[model samples]
Target: MGSEQLFGSIPPNWEYKTLGKACAEGGGDIQTGPFGSQLHASDYVPVGIPSIMPQNIGDNRIIEDGIARVSLEDAQRLSRYRVRVGDIVYSRRGDVEKRALVRNHEDGWLCGTGCLRVRVGEKNVDSRYASYYLGHPNVREWIVRHAHGATMPNLNTSILAACPFLVPPLPEQRAIAHILGTLDDKIELNRKQNETLEAMARALFKAWFVDFEPVRAVGAQFIAPDIAPDSMDTRNPGAINRAPTHWPPHILDLFPDRLVDSELGEIPEGWEVVALGELVEAVKGRSYKSEELVESETALVTLKSFARGGGYRSDGLKPFAGTYKAEQVVHPGEVVIACTDVTQAAEVIGRPAIVRSSTRYRRLVASLDTLIVRPKDFRITKAFLYFLGGTEAFVSHTYAHTTGTTVLHLGRDAVPSFTFAKPPAQLVQKFDALAAPVLERIQATEQESETLAQLRDTLLPKLISGELRIKDAEAFLKGRGL
Candidate 1:
């Protein structure tokens, strides 16, 4: 009969309004994604435009790193439910509280089945503010109450439209949104930067090791006929005249003149195929009792610490009060493999999360269920080793060695037995030189994002409820050098 008692009391200037009233007419504003019957599981493809489903809707963000997607044609067929930048989307059924704002990169992504989209069109309400408001504890309670179905709860368009929102003036609303959005924007930026850095490192790895791009460069030069009798440009591997602006002459110099065949495959003349265990070692985590856990500081990292099955989640850790061994303790830029698999369909058993360090917490110990993966020496950088943990060979090896029925467990003891092609020493050093800094930058960005997220979460409820004045928030931001 009445709106949920969110924020206790609304400011004198603010008023309550239904979500439907906050949207503009025509389309784009409020709608459910394509119905279940419209898009089948078979419609998903290995690569295409990201099809946003419930799994993609993370806490305050949409994570599609490992999400299922559909072909562009299918996305177009369901264009009416397409989500654009600035739109707010929610999980339509189970976990109805899950919500995420559509960012620029997510523009034109099809709003897949089991989701709801809300594009706030009201003059006074900020879209970001509305998105956050929808996730506010009070609004979540309202949605939970209205949500039907006992076995599997569900939400629909009618229910979402009827949801109430507490409104504020445009200026104040924008201020609240700006303060929070600043943090969200930085967090988003860090995520994108990490993705770029990882992509660059992966591409480089594949080029140098798998496809042997450098070898191709040298091979092309050797196989080509001499244009001008004898002397040729020695600096360029891919070209005879001169090297491309992007290709550094120093990297070209590292490529070997000849190639040789090995049991693993074709390798550079002097390179060898080595077991992965020889390059890096996995250190098992220490056990802790529930009674030993404290309510503060960094705790043991579980598989849940892996966001969307790959990304490291700094906030996902719980506090622990027990002591741990040096090997079990993880530091910044370290990778920990999940030894325990808890997914319903045995999804990510041996998945690894790059342990993130922050000023907000002390040491983070790996759980008994995780294995701290460390490079044997400077021969291989931690970044390179972390990337290796994601390679197909590593994943397949882990999946094959896994045991148990209901709860799958990767054989932590046999990590070293897994083998992979070893690159030349100079190439490995070159990779570390180029890739380590990118990884370091990623760790730094992740640390900043985590800190900003904590600040944003702390300020949210109070600021939106008008307990914290806008002027004070601006002063707070200024003090933080925002």
Candidate 2:
């Protein structure tokens, strides 16, 4: 298809010009990030001003996870490379088509090496509109085709500047941005809310199971001098504590007042150390060849499905063409654990994630890199096991069982051999009563965000190219109460 037909019809009065002209007219500048020599690896600090590297650039948003940082002095030295609000940042080499718009929170972050910063000052163009336009499939394809290097596509300032840019009137530009930005804003709000909900669930799990806070509260009421409620710091394996909440008389009665010794450590009075295998069965997933991975409705939850820390990443799914047993098909809310990790730091091996429902796929199966860990014993819930897998102690145990030099692989005994103090069936039920709703809410919110993202992605290209007019798009959103 020709460029014009591929990109869609440019509406009347829309300015078709080079991106360089748009930047020049807007009093903006396109510049490269700091080079390696200018900012050395040794300059990075544990915590300071964030430096936006290529990896940090996501789908028009900067991913904060695993992002690098630099000291104030270093940031000051690289002030010119500091990104401003509404600026667009792109990866200079790999994934050259991806870009992230700098939001207010990311303002003043250094545009680190292997990145290009596009600053469109207030004048003839809207940076948000430009960002959405660049995300067009046609534009992305053009960038990939024009990028230098056969093995590793690379992008420079000139290459980006020479790209086509379609500029509507300033008011129209703002309107298009508002239409798309509203959907994105809601998705972002859902994401932040999910984080809060997850934190709440994790806190509850730690208090009940790991810290034994409820039992400690009971002991405190009885004035057991040996059991100090404040001594939670020493007893907790993670050594991190959320502020203890005042337990109701009924809730306090659920836990035993005294503590007793166990094989793992000093657990609550009635709790006993139990092997994970006794509570859950680890079912290995289907192993398939690369040729079997084709564009289809069937998706496999590969290692990428597990977030680096411990969470589900929908983008990690691979369309599968192979078949497997009916039992291998994992449904939403099921627990899956990564059995392999290619990261040099072993960040993902043994991590657990709950499967999420997909809008685009009909079925999801676990890949060989992951194992479906289902609760065999009714006393424990999937929510409990998921949090248990995320605990520092459990992760440490699994890490010890891992064997590999470059690519870590979880041992067959990694999940089954691991052990933890099992709470009473009553306590497990009580915990589930409190945690299940929160988890459900999280899943619902995530599903809503996924739908919103799909809607946004669908509307983006059409709106950018003027195939779908602004008023019609507004009407569609209004009809849905968006």
Q: Pick the candidate with the highest TM-score.
A: 2
For every candidate, C-alpha RMSD to the true structure in Å: 5.9, 5.0
lDDT of 2 by residue, 1-482 (tens): 12233455578888677777788888898999999999999999999999999868878999898889999999999999999998999999979999999999999999999999988778999999999999998889988998999999999998888888888899999999999999999999888877766776787688778988778778876332222223223222232235334666677788998788878778998788889999998888999999999999999999889876789888889999899988889999999999998655477788899999988899999999989999987788988888899899989999899988878889999999998999888878877776677678888988999899889999999898888999999999999999
lDDT of residue 265 for candidate 2? 78
| Candidate 2, residue 251: lDDT | 71
Q: Per model, how many backbone clashes are there? A: 1, 0
Residue 25, model 1, lDDT: 32
Runs in model 1 with CA error above 4 Å?
A: 18-35, 46-49, 71-80, 84-86, 92-95, 104-108, 137-164, 219-255, 286-294, 322-326, 340-349, 403-408, 424-427
TM-score for all predictions? 0.81, 0.91
Whole-model lDDT per candidate: 0.75, 0.85
Q: Write the per-residue lDDT of candidate 1 for residues 231-328, one digit (tens) a residue.
A: 12222222323323233456667877567888867777777788877878788887878887776675888666776556587766778888878778
Give the C-alpha lDDT of model 2: 0.85
Regions of model 2 farther than 4 Å from truth:
1-6, 222-245
